[model samples]
Target: MKLRIVHQTVYRYDRPVRNLVQSLRLTPSVFEGQRAHDWVIEVGGGIRGPGFRDGAGDWIEGWTVRGPTEEVTVAVTGRIETRDTAGVLRGHRELIHPLAYGRGTAATRADAALRELAASVTEAADSLDLAHRLSAAVSDAIAYAPGRTEFHTTAAEALAQGEGVCQDHAHALISVARLRGLPARYVSGYLQAAAAGEAHEAAHAWAEIHVDRLGWVGFDPANRCCPDERYVRLGSGLDASDAAPIRGIAAGQGAETLDVAVNVEDVERLQTQSQSQTQS
Candidate 1:
């Protein structure tokens, strides 16, 4: 599957500001299930930018704007290719070293519950399918609910209460993989839909396991399945904080507000001029 994405972000101010700086992870990442064919970003205001790579291998852009500015617009357009490979990822072959994704970040710490879960799950890994089975077990153990916590919430807390969102799911999975000496990374992306017939809103996130021969393979614990053509992977990192699509701080004292709008639809249908596109 191929997709074209448009993401727009705006900052509104009650009073004029002086300067601004931001970190952007908007650029799509190339991993096992997805490929970035072509991509570009456009800012419609007075903004200066530079590109850099972060510790997690995510493409980062430092953007800054100067003074008394009312608004700034950042638009990203791109084409991505997707494939399904449940067998390509060989998690059993790769043993975890304290190099890349194994190290837990300041925000994402493995609490007692998470450590206990990992210890119990991989203690008797007699088969190569332990990761998958453990992932499914986590999905079964927790329920996906919103308004339960903020973005900075911890995995141990979620697992203790048996509840969380995609971030918690990914965090738990990453910690478990690390405990078992397998490499795992956090993935943030836009899910086309929740389930086969369910409605999806906004953005979605998941996790990827590093297999020696297969490289990185993704598993959507929220959906209880491996990522396929339906998923359009955007960026990946050590945890959600490193992989967040957008984050920044603005100068001011009054309350600041943010508004974001995103539309991820199949451009093939719209371009092919199908009946559905015509109707839409």
Candidate 2:
């Protein structure tokens, strides 16, 4: 599949900010399942710095805006060719040890409730089965509903509420996976809709667990399935905040408001041609 994506983020300040610096993890991951093409990242009136890959195989770039400015915009445009890898992450180079992800973050701390959730799924035949069961349990526990939670909402909080967005689902899954002694991490990315012309939310998020023989395998509780060609993985971390596409700090006390828009569309003609050639 060939996918075209456009993502835009605007931050508005009530008063002029003295300065701003941001770290971006917006580039798509290089793996067996996908490859990036014609990728570009632009920041309005901001200076771009050196680009490098982190230990987790995520592309990182720095941007600085020196100005008493009221607003700043970050835009990304790209095309990616993807294949169905059944959510198995292969051929991706990263230096971080799998055990490192087992460490808990504040957002993914498993309380008594989360511990019980993990305990309930302990009857699985193997680690892979347990991971699948855990994903289903999360989807059953937390219904996918937007505007019901905030960015800072923790996994425990979302579980108690029984509703949250994809980020909450990812956090909840990570919390339980860690409780079960499995290594898990959060993934940030873009998700093309299953059907044509179907609208989707802003950016998408999911979870990945390291399996014994399969290495890293992705699971999306919000979607109740493993990531396929429709998913474009950008980065991974212990939790959502850690894997955020954009993280920044602005000098001054002005309040900030954020607006985000993301569009993921399939290149129908290209896909058709690729499929025909494969069949021939």
* Clashes within 3 Å, all models in order: 3, 0
lDDT of each: 0.72, 0.93
Candidate 2 matches the true fold with a TM-score of 0.94
Model 2 stretches with alpha carbons more than 4 Å out: 194-197, 269-280
Model 2 over residues 77-131: C-alpha lDDT tens digits?
9999999899999999999999999999999998899888888886788889999
lDDT accuracy of residue 202 in candidate 2:
77
Candidate 2: C-alpha lDDT: 0.93
- Total backbone clashes of candidate 2, pairs 3 or more residues apart or in separate chains: 0
Using all chains and alpha carbons, the TM-scores for the candidates as numbered come to 0.82, 0.94
Best by TM-score: 2
Enumerate residue pairs that collide in model 1. 18-67, 90-211, 96-181
**Model 2 residue 218 lDDT?**
99
Please give, for residues 123-175, the per-residue lDDT of candidate 1 as tens digits: 54432366686687679767888878668887777787888898888888888
Best by lDDT: 2
